[model samples]
Target: MASPHRSDDLHQGDPVEDPPASYEPVNSDDALPYDDYEAEHRPPPTLRLRLAPWDVISTALLLTLLVVLATATNWPWRLYGFLSDVCTGETCGLVPFGVDNYIYPVVWGGIGAAIAAAGVGPFVSLLKGWYMSFWPVLSLTILMVSSVVGDSLTLFSERYWH
Candidate 1:
């Protein structure tokens, strides 16, 4: 004979029961406010600025590199000379396409400004509490200053030394 208390026999003939009268179905109207829930669960925005030692050091090194490139190298002048020489031949157009005196400084300055922006802009923004959105104006200012300095130095070297 089979046992009467077996698990299979216990549920074999049981009927489904209805929920109690006190029980109510949950709906959107009964839920907690979304804004409150989100505020409680979401993380707070950060206002602190963090910089690693390496980040500072690297930015300094990059600035130093830009200074060295701007002051030590005559590559801009050399490039200008080469480009100017290329246009001297008859095969070229009758109109001279020689590089202008003002061109290389602007080019070099623009290049230096770009390098500074890419490598050093973040540290500056972090320190000053400014956004990188101002990079263009900063870069333009750098370009103007660097171009003037570069041109002056090149002219001085050409006049006195060479």
Candidate 2:
């Protein structure tokens, strides 16, 4: 003996009511709004690796160290001469009279330029809200670890190669 308003209670043994015709669950995880036509034309997702400031700086530092280490290992006498001169001088004030005098500064300057260049793209990405800081920092850390291994190997080899 149910009133019309109490009809819902009479269906308690039945399955839950279906959604209303006009009801649209716009953002439900079970729903995908894209139709077949749109889905067919959609591009596949891609992963793009973009460099950041710190990544660039770390790369530059690693490159600079590699170059310096290689040169010193190959030409110990020349590196020793340069280090001796720099230590005794007020500053490395020697005229850029030859390759020997200019090479060290040029290498350092090149490293700086490389790092600066790396920063430019990431700065743009940061402005556009597409920047991810973690990857670059992670890459820098990897590069630093690799550089340490490389330097140690280079030193060990130099001992035998000499």
Candidate 3:
């Protein structure tokens, strides 16, 4: 229904208006009234890499300390384990007993993995599961791989260290 005060200019005595010469799409972000949000009090947004607002840099600076833990002299104690029927569920009587070489390797590998899974790596990812993109599991994988290839490198690198 037309307003009671409608005028002829508006097609029945209403005021005529001109169309806008320029068009600007209304963005949802901008559409929100600035006053509606407590922008002044809102904490700054942070990226997953930031950990706790600039903490990633500090964590990275101290990474040498963590990686150094893998250094041979720094961490000489190897975790060794046995493969008994009770532990591995195998028939052991017929075969000659072997040394328990697994206890240390896998133990260290898991320790490394746990660090990445629950420590700085996770914290660096803003504690989000998406940080798995960093391949946190690689921490343990590298330990296992190092245990194998490190032997080969030691023969060469050890020429000077030993």
**Rank ordering of all candidates by TM-score, starting from the highest:** 1, 3, 2
Per-residue lDDT over 18-128 for candidate 2, one digit per residue giving the tens place of the 0 to 100 score: 567797886777554446434543445545556577755655575556456546675334332333333223332333333233334443444354344445535655555
What TM-score does candidate 1 reach?
Answer: 0.34
How far off is residue 126 in model 1, in Å? 4.2
Candidate 2's TM-score reads 0.24
Candidate 2 C-alpha RMSD relative to the actual structure? 17.8
Per-candidate clashes come to 0, 0, 11
Error of 2 at 28 (Å): 48
Candidate 3, residue 133: the lDDT equals 34
The residue ranges of model 1 lying beyond 4 angstroms of the native Cα positions read 1-33, 36-44, 79-81, 86-120, 124-162
Q: Pick the candidate with the highest TM-score.
A: 1
Q: Per-residue lDDT of 1-162 in model 1, one digit per residue for the tens?
A: 222433433444544345566867588676455466545544455566765666556556655664665579984465344333322224433322332344455656576766678557776778766554445445545655665655554454343222
Give the lowest summed-lDDT range of ten residues in model 1.
Answer: 87-96
Estimate the TM-score of every prediction.
0.34, 0.24, 0.27
Residue 128 of model 1, lDDT score: 69
